[model samples]
Target: MLFRLSVIIVVMIALVLSSTWSVNVQAQGGDEPEECVEFIQQVLTDLGTNCAGGDPFQGCASHPVITLDIDEEETDAYTDDYLGLWPIAEDALEPEERAELDPRDRFPLLPAAQVDASRFDLANEEWGIAKLKVSLPHYPVAADQVEDTVFLAVGARIEDTTTPSDAYFPAAPIDISTTAETALREAPRANADVLDTAPSGVALAVDGISPDGEWARVLFTTNRLGIWDLAWVPTSVLDPTVDTSDLPEVEQDSRVPWQEIFLHDGYEESDECSLAPPSLLLLIGPDEDTAVEFWTNELYVKVRGATLFMIPPSGNVLMAYVAAGVLLVDPDTTDEWVIPAGFWGYWCLSEPDFYGGRVPPEPDEERERVIVPCADGAEFVRRLPDDDMQAWLAALLNPLGEEVPDIVETSGIGGPTIDLSFNNSDAIDPVRDACELGQLPPDICDLYEFPS
Candidate 1:
C-alpha cells in the first residue's frame, strides 16, 4: 500500500513539472517546444537509455528520425510546410522536353525507413516525430476535399528513442486516378490552371510524388507544341497495379498523304476518294448473318445478309449479297446481322474468290461486257460511267471468286474498315450524285432520312 501511494505521488509530480515546462517554452519561437524535450527524455529513460541529465542542450538532442503529430492542428501545419517544398514546372514546359524528368515516379520518395506516429502511442508519450495527415492538391478544385487526407511520416533521430517496429515502403511505379471526373492541372496545386480532364482508365504515367504521398506528378498527353506533358493529381484516386511506364510520352504522329500533322495509328489518306471525314467507313462481318451497319450519328445505313456494298460519301447505298438477296432496312430494326468488322476481308468486291455467284450464260456484245459470277450468283449492276462500268462490274462480279465468309475474324468495326484504293474519283461523284437525287431503292434512301 505504501509503494502504490509513492507511485501515484511521483506521477503527480511529473505532471506538474510537465505543465510548468510546457508553459515556460510555449513562446520560445523554436519548431520544437520544451514540452517535446521532456517527452523525449521520458521516452529515452523508459527505453533504459540515459541521456545523462535529460537536458537537450547538455545531453544528446532529438535527431528527427521521423515525425509524429499529436492532433489535428499539427497535422495541418505539417501539410502546409510540405506543400511549400513541392516542385513545379515552368510555364509552357513539357515534361517530355525536359532531360531531367525521370520516366518512372515511385511514391513515398523514400521507399523505406518511415513509420507512423500511432506506433509511438502509450500511456503518457504524447510527443514524438509528427506523422501528419495530408491531402495532395487536385485539378479543377474538387467539391469534397475531405476524403483526400492520408497519413505521412515526418521525423528526427533521437539519442536513444525506440526504432519503429512497423516500417512502410512506398508503392513502386506509383499510379493514381480520381473516382469521378477530375482534371489534370498544369501545376501541383488546387489553384493551378486545369490542363484537361482524365477519364477513368485513361492511364497516366507517374513522374514524382509529394513528400507526404498525397500528390503525384503525372505525365499526360496534350494537344500543345510538344504534345506530351506533366500535371498534378491527387494520390487518393490512384488505382492499384495500373502502371503505364512503357507508353511513350510523345505520341508519334501518323503519316497520311493529306494531313501533315501526325494522326493516330490505323488511319491513312486515300489517293482515290476526295477529302472526307474518316468517320466514313464500311464493315463486313465474319458470318452471313452478321449485318453491315454504317455510322454517322444515327445508324445511317444497314445491310443484312449482304456480303458487299458500293458506298460513296454522298449517302447513297449500293450493295450485293451472297447466297441471299440484300435486305436494306432501317438501322434500328435490322436483325439477323452483327456489325461488320472491316471492309478489306470477306466482303471485298475486289477479291475474286470472296463470293460465289452465277456467270451470265451469254455475253453482251453491244456493251462488249461479259457477265461474271458475283455475289453468290445474284448479279445486279448499277450503270456507272462508260469507262468505269466494265471494270467496276468485273471487280464486283468476280467470276472466278471462291467462297468467303460474311465476316472476317480480324477486322476493325469503327468507321470504314475496308481499304478501298480506287483512283476513279469521277465514278464516285456520279454515283453520289445519283444517290443524292433519290434514284436508289426507297429503303436505301430512307437510311439518309431523305424524303420518300
Candidate 2:
C-alpha cells in the first residue's frame, strides 16, 4: 500500500514544487481537469488533520470517495496512476468540507472485477494455490495512512473457530508399486490379518506412513472383491527410491487424521463473536519470535512467502485451497505434514460411525476420522472441470459494471456472502457413489444408473 502511495506522492510533490505547480493550481477553472491539482493540494494539506481526528477509524470513514480531474496540461504526468479510468480520491478533509460534498456525486473506483483481475490471484490459475494478503492494522500508527483497514476479501470469511481436538491430516495418496511381494495387513502391524499379497512389481497407492516409520497404509484391489480398498503394509516393501517421509502419519483403524487447518463446520457463527475468520486468508508474516496464532483451530501454521486459502467450513470439512509453492505445516507437538504446492488439504469431521458405512466406536473411546476415507479424501485427478471453473472465474476477472455471472451470486442474508451452492442439477456429474450413498437429492440421484 505504501509503495503505490509513495510513488504517487513523489509525483505529486515534484509537480507541486516545480515551476509549473502554481500555473496548474492557481488556474481559476473549478471544474476543469487542472482543478485536480487543487484537489491534490487540498487533500495533501489536510491528510494529517483529517486522518488523525479524534477517532481514527471513524475519522477516515468520514472522508468519502472523491473524483478529481487532473490538469489537462499535466495529465500525461500522472495519467498512469488513473489507469485510463477516473481515480476515486479517498482522503481526509475538514468537517465543513465533508458536509458540502455528496459522496454519491463522485465517480466510483474501478469495478471490483477490474481491480481484482489486476490484484488478486486466488488459486484459480494453477492447482491448489491462492494468496491471502493483508492490509489490517491493530490501530492507527500514522495520520498519512493509505492502507485498507477492511482486511476481508470477497470470497474469504473470518469467524470464531473453536480449538479442535488433537492434530489431523487428510489422506493425500499417490500411486507407487510394491518393492517386493508382501502380505497386506489389515493394520500396520505384521501380526494383523493378511488381506492379500501385493506382487513385487504391481502398482499400488500409499497414503500414510506409521508413527514408527515401520509400516505404510496402502490402497489396492483385493482378490476377493477386486475393488480398490485400503490395507496396511510394511514400509520396507514399498518402493525404496520413493520418499514416504512426507506422507501423513497413520492412526488406528487405517484412518488418516484431519490435521491441516481444522476449521469449524458450516455457516454457523459463535455467540462470543471473536471473529476468527472461518474463510478469510491472512498474511501473518510471522517471525521467529512471533507470539500470536491466527485462531484456535488445532494447528498453528506459520507460512513464509506462500499463499494459503482457508475454505468456508462446509460439509463438515475444514479445507485449504493450496498454493503453488512448497508450504510447510507444523503442529506444535507432532511431526509436520508437507503438502506439495499442487494439492489441496482439508480436515473432515467424522459423524456417527454408521454414516460412514462402518461400526460405531465405544462412547468413551470415540475419535475423529474421515467419513469415507478415500472417496471423501483428496484425489489427484488428470482433468479438472474447466467449464464450471470458467464460470467462477468470470466473477474474478470481470471489469467494473459488467453483469455478474449467474452462478456465485451473493446471498445478502449473511453479511456479504457468496452463494456457492449448485441449484441446477444439470451441471452435476453423475458420480455413481454420490447417488448410491444418498449424497444427492432423490430427484437428482435418479438421473444416474446403478447396478441392480
Candidate 3:
C-alpha cells in the first residue's frame, strides 16, 4: 500500500510539472519575454529606483539622490541688490518712464555658480516640485524709493517625493510663469499692486540694445485706449526662430501700410468681455472716402460711398463666410484660384444613404439605372441629373410616401408618384424671400441660424 501511494505521489508531481511547463511555453510564444521584462523594468523604475547599485531591490550600491537646500542668505542678498536698483511703488508709471529705470535694479540676476545638485533636486519624484529651481527677478516688496520701476516676475512651486516606495519618477523642468501671472493679475497682494496694474500709454521705440544689457524694452503705438503692459524679451526666449537662408525671400513693399483698429461690439465687466479701447482712426484714400472708424459701440469701414460694412466686436462672421465661399484671398499665396466659389456647397453623391439607395453595386455598364423618389416630387426630381439622381429620389420618397413612383417595378422608367400638393399655409413666400436675399429658405435659415 505504501509503494502504491508513493507511485501515485510521483505521478501527481509529474503532472504538475508538465502543466507548469506548458503554461511557460504558451506565455513565451504568445507574448515576447523581452518586452514583458522591459515593461516590468520601466514600472519598477518609475516606482522610485532608490535602491543600491541602480537596482531598486538592492540597497547601498546605487548613486546618491540629491536633495534641495535653499540658500536663504544668498536669496535675500540677491533680492536686496535687485530691489535697491529698481524700487517699486504703489503708483503706476508710463512705459517710457519705466524703461528709463535700470534693469539690474528692478530684476534679480541668477548666479550661474549657485546652480548645483542641491539647489535643484534632480531625483525628486513629484511632478510639481521634482525639477524646481529658483527663478530670480521675483519682486516680493514694493519699493517706494524708486520712480518708474517696472517689475516682471516669475515663481516656482516646490514638490517633495524622495521615498523609495513612491510611484513616480522625477519630472522635467516646467515654467509656472503663466500660471503665476494669471493668479497675480486676478488677485494681487496688498503690497504688490504695482505689478498688477499695466503702464499708461507712453511709447518707447526700442532701438537695438547692447549685448551685455540685462533687459530690452520696446514700445509700439496702438489705437486702443486702456492701460497696457509691454514685456520685452529676446525673440529666442519666446519661440525658436526659423533659419531664413533656406526659405525663398519675397519682395518687400516699402509703401505697404497697415492700420490697427480696436472694434468693440458691447461692454461688460466679465473676463470674457474685457477689451482695450479705441485708437486713432485713419483714412487710406481721398477725402476719407476709404476710411476706418472706431467708436465705443461700432467699427465702420467705408469703401468709397457705395459700400459700407460695420463689424461688431462680437459676432464677426464676414471673414468666415467669405472664407467658406472661397471669395477671400489668402494673402500668403500667389495662386489666384486656390479657392473656388461654391466649393463649400458641393456635396459628394457617392454616399448610398445620401441618395436613398442601398450600397451601390460595383461599377458595371450593363446594370439598369435606378430611379429614386425626390423630397419635393417634381421640383426636387427635376434637379436630379448625372450623379445626383439618387440623392433627389431619396429626398422625394423620404417617408415612404404613398405616391412613390413605380420605379422599383418598372426598372428605370417610373417610380411610385410622390404627392406634390402643398398645404395652404405652406405657400412659397418664404422660399421667394430666401431666393431674393441669396440665402437658404426661411425655414432652413431658422434651423441653421447662430444661437442667440
Candidate 4:
C-alpha cells in the first residue's frame, strides 16, 4: 500500500510541473502580426543590432527600444516623383499672373503613375532596433490632368508603448493637401478685422507681407495658453488692400515687414529671431481631422499651413510620425522644424504680455549645485567640464536661500517609480542651499511628498 501511494504522489507532481512549463511557453509565444515582426526586425537591422537579443517577447529586457522606418519609395515619390509635376516656371509666375487661371485649374495634382511597393523593405534588414512601417496610397491626381500637382496619403504602424509587445497601424492615411496659386491669392481675406486693433486683453501685431499683397504674417498672444502664435496668410483677404494713394502716413501703421515682425525678449536682436524661410514653412496644426473637416466645405479656412493636423498627445506618437515624414522629405533641414517643447496647450490668438504677468516664481538659491535624481534613479550632477571646482562652487553659493534638490533615486516600486533625495538625505530644505532650484515645481514636490 505504501509503494502504491508513493507512485501516485510522484505522478501528480510531474503533471503539475508539465502544466507550469506549458503556461510559460504560451506566455512567451508572440501572437503579434507578421508584418509587425518584420517591421521590428527592420528597425533593429537599421540600428546595427541583431534580433536575437532585441526581440520584445522572449527577451529579458523590460523596456523595448523605439525605432523608425521610412518608406524610401514613398519618400522618393515625394522628392523625385512630385517634383516632376511642378511647372518649370512656377517660381516666375507673379501673383496676378497665376491668379488669371481658374481656381480649379491651379490646384497642384499628383501624377497618375503607381508606386512600386517592393521598394518598401520592412523585413530582412539589419537588426536590434524597434520597427515601424508605413504604406501610403499613390499620390492623388486630377481627372483633367491639366494640373500636375500632387497630393499624398500616408499610413503608418508603430510599436505600441502601452503594450510594448504589440504594434498598431493607422486606420486612415494622413493626407497632404497641396495649395493652388489661386487659393494662395485668396488666403488673406479670411483674417479677423479686430486683428488690426491691439485690444487690452489680446495683443496682435502684423509681420511680413508678400510683395504682391497676397500674404500677411501676424503674431498674437493668448492669456489662457501662455504662449505666442505667429501665422501667415494672404493679405488681400485679411483687410481690403490699402490703396497706395490712401495709405496711412504713420510709419508703424504701414505694411508690416517680415524682418521687423518677430518679437524679441530684449533689445538685443539678431538673425536668430527671424522666421523660417517661406519654402521651409509648412504650417501644420489644429490637427489632421480638424483640418480636413474644416477645409472640406467651410467658407472660411481656419487652419492653413503645411500639414497642420490634430493628434493625441500620448507618447507624442503623431508628432513623431509627422516629424519622420518631414525629415524624410527634407533631410537636410528636418531637424530645424522639430516639434516645440510645449505644443499640447490650446492655441489662442491674443496680444503680447497677455499672460506675461503670471510668470512662475523665480528659483531659490542653494538648490543649484545639487545632484538631482532622474526618472531612472540615476544621479545627474551638472558639472562644467572646463571650469574649476571653485568656480562651480562659487556659482552654486552665490545665490543663497534657494533650495535645489540635486539627488534623485527610485521609489523602489514597480512601474514608473521615482523618488528624489537631496544631498543623500531622506529630508533636506531646498531653500537652505546656496543655488537656486529650477525643475522641482511646488506641485510636483507636493505630489512626490518631498519635505517642505
> How accurate locally, in lDDT, is each candidate?
0.28, 0.33, 0.20, 0.22
Please, what are the lDDT tens digits per residue for candidate 1 over residues 223-248?
21111345777766667455534322
For residue 78, model 3's alpha carbon misses the true position, in angstroms, by 4.7
- Residues 325-416 of candidate 3: C-alpha lDDT, one tens digit per residue: 11112211242111111111111122322221223354222212121222223311222222233232233223222111112211234653
TM-scores, all candidates, are 0.17, 0.28, 0.13, 0.22
Candidate 3 lowest-lDDT run of ten: 146-155
Give the Cα-based TM-score of candidate 4 against the true structure. Answer: 0.22
Ranking by lDDT: 2, 1, 4, 3
- Over the stretch 234-261, how does candidate 2's per-residue lDDT look in tens digits? 8787778886666767655321111122
**Of 3 and 4, the candidate ranking higher by lDDT:** 4
- Candidate 2 TM-score to native: 0.28
lDDT comparing candidate 2 with the true structure: 0.33
Show model 4 residue runs off by greater than 4 Å. 1-215, 220-227, 231-409, 412-452
Residue-wise C-alpha lDDT for candidate 4, range 1-452, written one tens digit per residue: 11111111122112211212110011113333445444533332222221121211111100122122223233333343334333323432222121222111112222211111111223332112111111111111122221110111111111111110111111121111222221221224554333323322222234345345555544433321122333444443333433322211211122211101111111111122111000001122221111110111001122211221221211111111111011111111322121211011111112222211222233222111111222322211111112232232224223321122222233354644434333312113221110123223454445335332
TM-score of 3: 0.13
Q: What's model 2's lDDT at 228?
A: 38
| Deviating ranges (above 4 Å) for candidate 1 | 1-181, 184-237, 251-384, 387-393, 396-452
The alpha-carbon deviation from the true structure for residue 226 of candidate 4, after best TM-score superposition, in angstroms, is 7.6
